[model samples]
Target: MSSYDFVVIGSGPAGRRAAIQAAKLKKSVLVIDDRGSVGGVSVHTGTIPSKTLRESVLNLTGWRERQFYNRRSTDNPQTNCAALNSRLSKTLLHEVDILEQQFARNNVHTLQGRATFVDKNTLRVERREADRTAVELVTAERVLVTVGTKPFRPDNIPFNNRTVLDSDAIVSDLTIPKSLTVIGAGVIGIEYATIFSALDVPVTLVEPRDSFLDFVDREVISNFTQQLLDRGMSIRLGCSAESIVLDENDWPVVTLSDGRVVRSEMLLFAAGRKGATDDLGLENLSLEADHRGRLEVNPKTMQTKVDNIYAAGDVIGFPSLASTSMEQGRIAACHAFNAPMPDAPHHFPYGIYAVPEISTIGYSEEEAKAKGLLFECGVARLRETSRGHIMGLQSGILKCLFELKTGKLLGVHVVGEGATELVHVGQAVLNLGGGIDFFMENTFNYPTLAEAYKIAALDAWNRMAHERSGKVIKLKKRKVGKKAA
Candidate 1:
């Protein structure tokens, strides 16, 4: 039996970060994962893989280059699936190497094994080796579980990794289908749908709900929908998949509940994510997980119901992003070691790396309205900016919500190229409680997309002035004008 100051299960973003933090605090830390490598889901299948695919599509298609070329520029700029797969795999492996080195530098032990609770303060780790029986070990004083989540697929659909794919298997493919049917319009599904569309693959996106990404601002989603349609992506909303069967050629024929059948060369199920909690032996710790096998934790401290344990990332639920997860992991470690824990960022950006991108931070328009707060809205169209027009931006918009009375900025939402990066400016303002007046008094350089922010502020100012003057005129007109007429 071996022991450590801290043990983190799953070498994903959260687990690795926590282990490193604990080690930095001069504590013996061990990170155990079932995968042979580190970097976990984020590097393997979730964020990095998806973004790499998006970049590959953009580059191969010369989508951005088309802005400067004639529409008749018929050069396809050919790229094979093998090339993409090779590049992505190489890049991911390199990243994992760097992560491994980071752990090594921090003196954090990396174990390739599966871990489960044996008691409140004990974990059983089973390691596998070639042509050998599994080796078992007991380790850890305190544990942090950051196992992440797995793609969810309906029971009716056959998840034959070759033809029918989930999020994990989708990225490992070296080929693009002629036609693909994507179930679910969540982030993962939306990303792949757009990537395939950009690659000239016909895609039919099916979502049972009328809307997707309900947490995001409605205006942003509306803009995304238009962008998807403009790119030749077909969407079927409020439609459920009744069944999926193979055609004569072994292609997928997806039947929707509305009696509509969609035939495609490939099928992708991206409904949602289920917690990676199976086989963890939570019962040993006297703990149980939810329906999705996700554990609940303290939002601030990230400690589970069991005091000596903590959980973070997707396994802990909403806003399960790599950036947030890393911070959560560090915080959990700090708290566990009784070290000084810094305050979490007052405002964090939510970035959706879809085609053209979408990002937001701070309050939503509905949230402000529901509070009955007096507000003004500022909107900037990408087409109005010289940079946007030069970039061949057909559709891009930035909107800012402000408290009318106090002139304080409430929220910012952006949809367009580099929108994810651009939203940080607004995030800084909102976090500092700065108002539209800041943009009003500042200059954002000529011909830049950032100028749109200032332009939008002016737009709102004009509307507000007009409303105020109009009200004043109405009040005077109702006073009889002292018989001047």
Candidate 2:
């Protein structure tokens, strides 16, 4: 038996952060992962893999250069599947090496095995080496579960991994698919669909929901949809896949509930992901996970039903982002050690790494309306900016929402090139409670995307002033007419 101050299960963003934070406080920490690698899903399969592939495709195919130069100068066979896969392999290797060094330098111990709960404070880990299996018992004063999530696989779908694939498997088994069909219009589906579309592959996106990314600002979604259509991607909304059959060529033929048929060279099912917790044996602690295998925790402290045990990352659900999960793990570790938790801002940014990307922070226009708050919105198209012209961008938008009565900035939403990076400027202002005056007074560098903030702010200011002045003019006209009569 081995004992430690903190034992974190799963080495995803949340688990890694928690283990390292606890170790930095001089507490002994041990991280156990079934994969035997330090960089969890985020590094191995999810975020890193997808984003790196997006970049590789863009660079290898000269996506940006083709905008200025002709396609003849950019298109080549070197940007094919083999080259893209090679780039993904190189990037993953580099990331894994860095993570391993970090864990070693922090003096955190790692074990390779599947972990199951023996009790509230004890875990039984099963290790398989060659033809032999071994069991070890480990106890810790505090335990954190951050196993993350996996793609949901329904029994009805025949996932042979040859013609059909899920979100996780597609990254590893990628080929230069001639035509692709993607199910679901969530973040993952839209991202992959657009990425392949950029490669000039015909992509059909099917979603059961009528609206795409309803949580995002409608205007931003509208622009995104238009861009997808302009790129020759087919979108079928309010349509569900009734069945998928393989044709004579082993290609996937999908039948929609609406009686539409889509034939493609390959199919990707990315409808949703469920928490990875079935092997954790929560029943021993009398804890029950939800239908999706998610555990509930106190929002503020991230403590599970048991006092010493905590849950973070995708296992706890909602806003399951690598950026946010890292913070949750750090905070959970702080509360476990009775240390002061750092003050976190109320608002956090969300970034989707699709082609022409999308990112936002704070309220959406619909959210402000649902709350019944008097607010106004200002928008600036990327085409209006000098940087947009230089980059040959035809479509992009930056939107700002502000409280009508107070003039305080409430939200910032963006869609287009560098949308993820440009959003921080608005995020800073929103978090600091800065109003229209902040952007008006600030001097942004000329000929940059950041200038969109200044343009958006001015648009809002003009509208507000026009409304106020119109009201005052009406009052003056009434007084003059009364006096003359």
Candidate 3:
């Protein structure tokens, strides 16, 4: 039987990262996955595929041309799905190949098989290839289970290959509908809506909520809503598809909960994702999943009920991005080895790949109030910055929250160009326990979006001054007056 110091199941972001981290520490590692390829959903269905399509749409359809030059001015403004798919596929495959090479360089053994828990210290690995064979495997003392999530498909929906599709199916070029109906206004839904809409395919987005992106700041969502509307996308919030039927033309006809009937060439259910822990004999190990089939991991160490078996990524659920999952995987591996590692970052960024991106780190405004902390909000619109003006940014905003009493930076939220990139500044500040004073004193590049952090800090300082009572004002002046003044 093959053996290693560490065996990571599922070669996704979390598993791959965990293996790499362990390998870096001179641990023999084996990474097993069911898929024939590497890089997991991030490379295949989720991050790379979507972002590549977004970029392809922007370039081919001249969406970015509309920034400085109008689409009408482009020699060829129309885009085709085949072209976007061809490019996206090529790039995605190259990325997966590179990741495979990296694993090889690190001497991490990748086994193409399905792994099942024989016991806490043993696994039964069924190898799948030209000559299939079952092999009894002995598990390592430390195991990292980073099996990610899969797109949730509900039984109520009639999901025929032609008329209805899931997120994974859309990655293939087979069903590029002329007009599409997308359910769920969460990140995936909004992203697909924007992508298809950008391709000039009429898209109708339905959500069973009063607002889109409710988790994000309201102003940011409003701006995104405006952008999507401008692109000729239809949004129906507080409405859900009661039933879906295929027309004689093999198109999808959906009846909403509000008694509204909508027809589309295709229907995409981006409802959400569920953990990938269903079939790995989790029950045998006495591990249980919640309603969403996600493991309840210790937020501190990411260990499941069984201390030796650690879970990370979407399997554990929430903040389920490739970047965060990578970090969690590395941390889990470190914890498994009992390696001396620094504390996890206090603030982690959340990125939603909608038309206009949304990203945030740290506490939300409501969370601050719920915690009964004295806080102030600072806001800056992208239009207010010269960089935004030069880039033709029509709508985008950055909001910062700070602890009023101690001047500690609480949160940073943004929706606009480079929202994901801009969140790092806030992350650094939050990690260091830096406050509004740090932002106000620092000088950012001229006419840059990063200036929003400074502007937001000043805004918070002004509000803190206004909200403080006489006694509080004296305390603030005595401590932070030099910086604010």
**Most lDDT-accurate candidate:** 2
> By TM-score, who's the top model here?
2
**Segments of candidate 1 deviating more than 4 angstroms:** 70-78, 466-485
How would you order the candidates by TM-score, starting with the best? Answer: 2, 1, 3
lDDT winner between candidates 1 and 3? 1
Q: How do the candidates rank by lDDT, highest first?
A: 2, 1, 3
Clashing pairs in 3: none
Colliding residue pairs in candidate 2: none
Task: Give lDDT tens digits, candidate 1, residues 14-73.
Answer: 998899999989999988888878988998888989998888778767777666773321
TM-score of each: 0.93, 0.95, 0.91
Local distance difference test, each candidate: 0.84, 0.88, 0.82
Clashes found in each candidate (C-alpha, N, C closer than 3 A)? 0, 0, 0
* Stretches > 4 Å off in candidate 2: 72-79, 467-485
How do the residues 1-485 of candidate 3 rate in per-residue lDDT, one tens digit apiece? 77788889888889888999999989999888877787777887888888888877767767655777766322332346567768987998899888889999999988878888877767788876577676758578778888788889889888876679888888766446769999998889888888778777889999998877666766567777887888789899999889998889988999999999999999999999998778888878898898888988887888989988898987888888888899889989898887877887767888887667789888888777888987889998887777888888788889998877777888899987889899999999899888876777666788789987877776776777766666452332323322234
Model 2 earns a TM-score of 0.95
**Model 1 TM:** 0.93
> For residues 320-372, could you state the per-residue lDDT of candidate 2 as single tens digits?
99999999999999999988996889999999999889999999999999999
